[model samples]
Structure formats: structure tokens, C-alpha cells
Target: MINRYGPYKRYKQVFGVTSHSNPDKEHTVVITDKGEWQCSCPAWIFHTPRKPCKHIQEAMKDQVVQAFTPKPITPKVEKVLNRFAAIEV
Candidate 1:
């Protein structure tokens, strides 16, 4: 995720969606590194308050697999783990 720009990052998954009206057409839906949702569609351009386009919506729902979140270990648990690590098995 890091680049010469320093801490540069972007979503690894980019969705290419076929147009509902025109099957020949397609759009790109992605979440920017800044955590902004965007779509490469006309509606994605003209909206005053940006809203999720149909393609973006579909892409979101399709994202069944998500990034993992690690649970924080309590201090008491950490202490027990440290003790176990010091023991010679």
C-alpha cells in the first residue's frame, strides 16, 4: 500500500459493472484510499450530495469477503501468554 507518495494506499478490489440499460456499457466502482465511494457513471458525476449508484450498490453487496479485524487482547490475557511463552516445553 505504500508508495513514493508516502503511505499511499488504495482498495485492492475494483468492480467493473455492466450498465443496466446498455449492456454494452460498463462502469468502474471503487472505494478510494480516502474511504470515499465512487463510481464511473453519469449519476456519479451530477449528484449534488453524492449517492451510491446502482453499480456501486451491486458491488457493495457482492463484497461478501471483507478485511479482517484483530481483537485486542486484555492485559490479563497478555500476562498469561507471556508466562506461557517463558515456560520451557
Candidate 2:
């Protein structure tokens, strides 16, 4: 099974991501403040030094998509400048 941890906001400017195969296991990937990625999984620690693990790849994909997606623009309501002008009293 797979689990996703975050597109979590860190400090102010940095974003973090973590994921694992199961909730009981250690984090598979952690994207740090300096934009460096770390994975605690055995494959990362032993085999893949120059390449990112699957968890890191997934998280980075999410972050990249989110960054480019446009935010919804809310329409502004115009208020009457002279609401009392038409009042008889």
C-alpha cells in the first residue's frame, strides 16, 4: 500500500513532502527547505544514490503541477456610493 504525506507548508517559503508504503513505516521521502530530497528507504540508502526514489518522484510531480495551476478568481461586488439618496425619510 502507498500513502502520501504532504504538500505541507514549512516555515514560510518552503514546502515539504513525505510518503511511505505504510503508516507504520518511516517516511520514504522528505523534500527539504533547500529543495533537497531525502529518502529513508533502503533502496535509496543502498542502491540509488544519483536517482530519486519513486516517492520523491511522485511528490515532486505534485508540487510542480500545483505551482502551475491557476487559482480561482473571485468576482468583486460593487456597492452603492449613495444608498441614502433615494430614501424619503
Cα-based TM-score, every candidate:
0.58, 0.41
Give the true-structure RMSD of model 2: 19.9
Give per-residue CA lDDT, model 1, range 1-89, as digits (tens): 10011111343445556778877665655555666666667786567677898887887776664553323443433343334223212
Residue 4 of model 1, lDDT score: 10
Give the range where candidate 2 is weakest over 10 consecutive residues by summed lDDT: 75-84
Predicted model with the maximum lDDT: 1
How well is each residue in 1-89 modelled by candidate 2, as lDDT tens digits?
32333333321111223334455543334454556665554565566334687755665666555434322221210011122123212
Pairs with steric clashes in candidate 2? none
lDDT against true structure, model 1: 0.52
Off by over 4 Å in 1: 1-9, 65-89
